[model samples]
Target: MIIRSATSDDVDAIWELNRQIGQYHFENVPDVFVAPSHLDREFLLAAIMDEHRLFSVAVDEERIVGFISARMDINENIPFVIKRPLCRIGSVVVDEDHRAKGVGKKLMEHCSSWANSNEAYQIRLEVMSFNSKAKSFYESLGFKPQSEIWAK
Candidate 1:
């Protein structure tokens, strides 16, 4: 497995990987995740060019198998509190066949290196409450629950 920076050529594969994750979330929480559509492609393209964003892909035999995208987030919307920058994992997805083979871990290690170099104090991501597998994967990486969002 080769982990490297994402290029324009990888966009289509990345989009497909992203769609799989979106489908999973939509299946698990339709209220929070919309069905995958062309609009997501535009959103991802913008993310690729955004200065605060970092995108990487994992390739095997010249095929893109996984990708991770993160952005530096400073909580500017909240007032009256000292704000610290966070490295927020926007999306991290590995192909179903390639999972459990360390692809995700390599992607995250790259993200952590980028975050630390950028002076981000924390790395954060949100997993749907119903996705126990994802929550467990994150927990194994030293992530703990900071808060929960409850809905009726």
Candidate 2:
């Protein structure tokens, strides 16, 4: 498998993967997520073109198997908080058939390298409470929870 920066040509496959994950979220957290549809292709293309962001895809045998999107940003400016650069992962999805085959890990590792190159001090992402499998996958990568958001 090869990991590379995403291009316009990869949008449809990425969108499909996004839909797959989005549906899972919608079902698991209906209060927070709605069924995903009609994603704006132009917006996705814009993300691909954005210099501060990284959108990448994992391909095997000419088929897209996974993707990750991340961006560099500064930690919020608060008097008590130390300022630092961070890479926030916005989304990651692996094709159902490609899970447990290391496609997701490879994609994440690619993003980590990119983040380091950009001088980021840390990497962060959110996994819903219901997704134990994803949580385990991330934990195995050495990620630790830094905060939690509680809802009524």
Candidate 3:
């Protein structure tokens, strides 16, 4: 397996991997997620082209098996809070067949390197409360919850 920065040529493969996770979210959280079809190629391409965002993919035998997208931003300007740069992971998906094989971990490691190079003070990501598998995976990586969102 190899991890590298994504390019325009990787859009299709990345989209397919995104669909895998998108489908899971749509089925498990219908209220907040739409079908994977709603996430069109153009939207993904724009994200890849964004200067503040970094997209990386894991390839195995020349086939893309996973991807992660993250963006660098400053903490919101608030009088009481200290300002700092942070990296927010937007999406991460490993092929269903590739799970538990460290593909996701490699992609995350790549994201961490990118974030550090960009001078980010922290890395943050969100996982739905019901996605226990993802939550556990994140915890295994030393991530602790900072907050939660509640909706009625």
Candidate with the greatest lDDT versus the true structure: 3
Task: Please give, for residues 1-152, the per-residue lDDT of candidate 3 as tens digits.
Answer: 99988899999998888888888999998999889884568899988888668888899999999999999888586878658888999998999999999998999999999999988889999999989999999999999999999999
lDDT of 1 by residue, 1-152 (tens): 88888877677898899899889888888987899999998888777777668998999999999999998878888798559988989888999889888899899999999999989999989888888888888999999998888998
Flag regions of model 1 displaced more than 4 Å.
Answer: 77-80
Q: Give one digit per residue, the lDDT tens place, for model 2 in 41-141.
A: 66677888887799999999999989899998885868797578889999889999999999999999999999999889999999998999999999999
Residue 74 alpha-carbon offset, candidate 2, angstroms? 1.0
Model 1 residue pairs with clashes:
none
What are the TM-scores, per candidate, against the unseen true structure? 0.92, 0.95, 0.95
Q: Give me the displacement of residue 58 in model 3, in angstroms.
A: 0.5
Residue 38's lDDT within candidate 1 is 90
lDDT winner between 1 and 3, please give it: 3
| Candidate 2 backbone clash number | 0
| Candidates, ranked, TM-score | 3, 2, 1
62 Cα displacement, candidate 2 (Å): 0.7
TM-score, structure 3 vs. true? 0.95
Ranking by lDDT: 3, 2, 1
Model 2, runs deviating above 4 Å: 40-42
